[model samples]
Structures are given as structure tokens and as C-alpha cells.
Target: MEMSNMPLGGHWVLVIIMIILATWVIYRYLAPQNAKEWRNAGLIQGFIIALYAEMYGFPLTIYLLTGFFGLEIPWLHMRGHLWSTLLGLGDVGAMIEMIIGLGLVILGLLLLARGWSQVYKAQKENRLVTDGLYTYVRHPQYTGIFLILFGQLVHWPTILTLLLFPVIVVAYIYLARQEESAMRKAFGQKYVEYMKRTRMFFPEIKNWKLLFKKG
Candidate 1:
């Protein structure tokens, strides 16, 4: 369903419901209590809600400019299938981008799931994680989010979304850095040693091969 249709065809009532639901979902996932974590989580939640709202709730910018776009533009059809409109795809290309975007979304979700599971397990034992997805990126959760957002952008590049993309990207990058600082402080010299061997967002091939080398 188009995001704008979340309120059932620009219905204000439905939009309110979506806002409530989004708030609940973000609160649950972010789980922020303290000041710092709460602030960070708020930023994350805001980014998520903003993206989804524009994605499925309402393409207001698109609709508002339809008159200027000409009568034969078929804005309704495009709004109904919002992603297709943004990606500039016609038929097969649209299908391809949609499939790819869906794939990336699934992959991002899986990465998040796996990363969360690992962290939860470590916390249960009061240990630190330096393996699995963590071995590849210091912040797989943020990376997954970026991947998901990128996938969405590729699938649908609306004016509002496009404008917000860079800002969102910068914000996430800042958050990731903040998280790394906390982690480094906690892990101390061990983390310092690990940093020498790990890349923040990209995996080092030599390290990967060494870590996976067969005895």
C-alpha cells in the first residue's frame, strides 16, 4: 500500500492511526530509557518514521505538484505505486528495481536480526562481540539501516525523500561514530587492538581470509 494510503487515500484519520502505530513500533525497537540512549534512539526513530510515512503514508509533494506536471501525467497511478514513480522505471526496469529493493530489505532485516541475536547472547553472558557481523562492521545495525534506506531510495526517489536522504545518511554516520566511541571506551585496549584489524564499514579481505583460513 502506498504510504499516503495508510490513512486510506489521504484520509486524516488513517494518518493519525499510522502515526500512533509508528510511534509504538519505534518505541519498542529503540527501547531508550536514559538521556543519551533516549536521544540517539529518538533520532533513529524519527528517521524511520519519516521514511515510512513518505514511502507508504502520503506522497504529498508529488500530489501537490501534479497540476504543474500536466493533466495527462496520471499522478494517481504513480501515487498508487509510489516506488515506481521515484525510480524512473517504466515496465521491466521497475519490476527489476522492485525485486532488488525487496531483496535488499530482506537482507537488511536478516542482518539486523542476526546482529541483535548475537549481541543479546553476549549480554546474557556479560561478554563483548568481536565476531560474525561485528567482525565485518563495528555497527551492523546502522549499516543494515543504511542498506535498507539505500534500497528504498533506489526503488523510489521522491523529491522529499531525495532531499532528506543525505541528511539521514549524515545523521546515521554521526550516530555510528557516537556508538563506536562508547564501545571503544568500554572495550579499552582490547577494542583498540581490534580496531587495528577491522574496518568500520568495509571488511578487510586479508583479515577475512585469515579469520576463515582452514587449518
Candidate 2:
């Protein structure tokens, strides 16, 4: 079948499934508790919708690239892997990028799960969580979110998603700061000291091994 004539869109079922799965994972693990967290989660929800809509429901990005920009690209679903297509990597290259993206998504999920586990335990004890993923970054959940979003971008670079990526990043950073402010009020000097010792998002290079360490 010709790439242009191949079934390129109307996969609403797949899109809905992806959105539901992504949103479920986000809410289940992150468990946004406040308005700020909810707002950030909304942004992620928008991102997920835009991503899958383009990935399955409609190839708007592909359409624009080939139609508006006059790029000589095919309209096949596989050809929608723009990064691999643009990089001239072909099918093998697309597979490689997909693998890398999947790896990142898995890592991000692990971080979210581990961070939630530690935080849930600490909350039960009414103490600050400063072990496991928390020992590395002050906001491992946010870090995981970034990783997941970036992984999706790497896997499929759609126009809408590419634009939304940085906006989501900024929103999460703001939300993280707001959460930290509340943490300071709740934990006082202890949180202040933790902030001093730990980075907000990224972990220190030397402490990278702790991410693999089992608690």
C-alpha cells in the first residue's frame, strides 16, 4: 500500500486507551494533593491528549510537515516517527529511538513508584522523606514526570507536543517551588536543611548510584 493511502488516522480507540493508561499512571503514582499539583497534572493531561491524538487519532503534525512545509515525507503511521525520519535513520533508527524512549519511560515510572513508596511511608510516620530517591533529588516525582514527557518527545516529535513540552516543564517547576514553600511551613528548619543538601530536580552526579540501590 502507498504510504499516503495507508490508514493514517481515525484510531480513536487506541488514542483513548493510551490517554486513559497514561492518566491512570500519573494520578495513581503522583497522587496530586493540592491545587498546584492538580494544575500541573492538568498540563500533563493536556500533553498526553495532544500526544496520542497526533500519534493515533490524527497525523496533524505529519500533515503540516508534508503539506504546509512541503516536505517530501510519507503519511504512514511508521513515518510519523519524525525524529528517525528526519535523521535519515529509516525503520531501524525508528526502532532504536523507540527502545530508548521506552527505556526512559520505564525509568521514569520506577522513579515515580519508588518516590511514592518512600513518601507514603514517611507521611505515615509524619516525617520528611529523605531516603531512596528523595536522598538524591528533592522532587523525584517531578523528575520522573520530566523523564516521561521527554521520552514521549524522543519517541514521537509531534508539533503540538514539542511546543507543549517546555510549557509543561515550567509549570512543574513552579509547582515544585510551591510545594517546597508548603513543606518549609510544615517541616521548618528540617526542610530548609534538606533543600540545602539536595537539588530540586536533578540528582548530584556522585549520588547517582543511590538510584540503583535498594532500600
Model 1 vs. true fold: TM: 0.71
| Model 1 agreement with the true structure over 1-215: per-residue lDDT tens digits | 86333331344465567667656744554445567656655665565555556555666555655656642223453343444544555555657776887777666655655666677878798878888777777766665556666776666555665666676668767766877787789989998887787777546765544422322
Question: How does residue 140 of candidate 2 score in lDDT?
Answer: 89
At residue 28, give the lDDT of candidate 1: 51
- Candidate lDDT scores, in order, read 0.61, 0.86
Tens digit of lDDT per residue, candidate 2, span 96-177?
A: 9999998888888888888888889998998888877887799988888898999999998788888989999999888888
The candidate scoring highest on TM-score is 2
Inter-residue clash pairs, candidate 1: 2-56, 3-56, 3-57, 3-58, 4-56, 4-57, 4-58
- Give the Å shift of residue 171 in candidate 1: 2.3
> What is the model-wide C-alpha lDDT for candidate 2?
0.86
In terms of lDDT, the poorest run of 10 residues in model 1 is: 71-80
What are the models' TM-scores?
0.71, 0.92
Superposed by TM-score, candidate 1 places the C-alpha of residue 116 at a distance from the truth, in angstroms, of: 1.4
- Identify the runs in model 1 with alpha carbons over 4 angstroms from their true place: 1-8, 11-30, 51-57, 68-73, 77-88, 204-215
RMSD of 1: 5.3
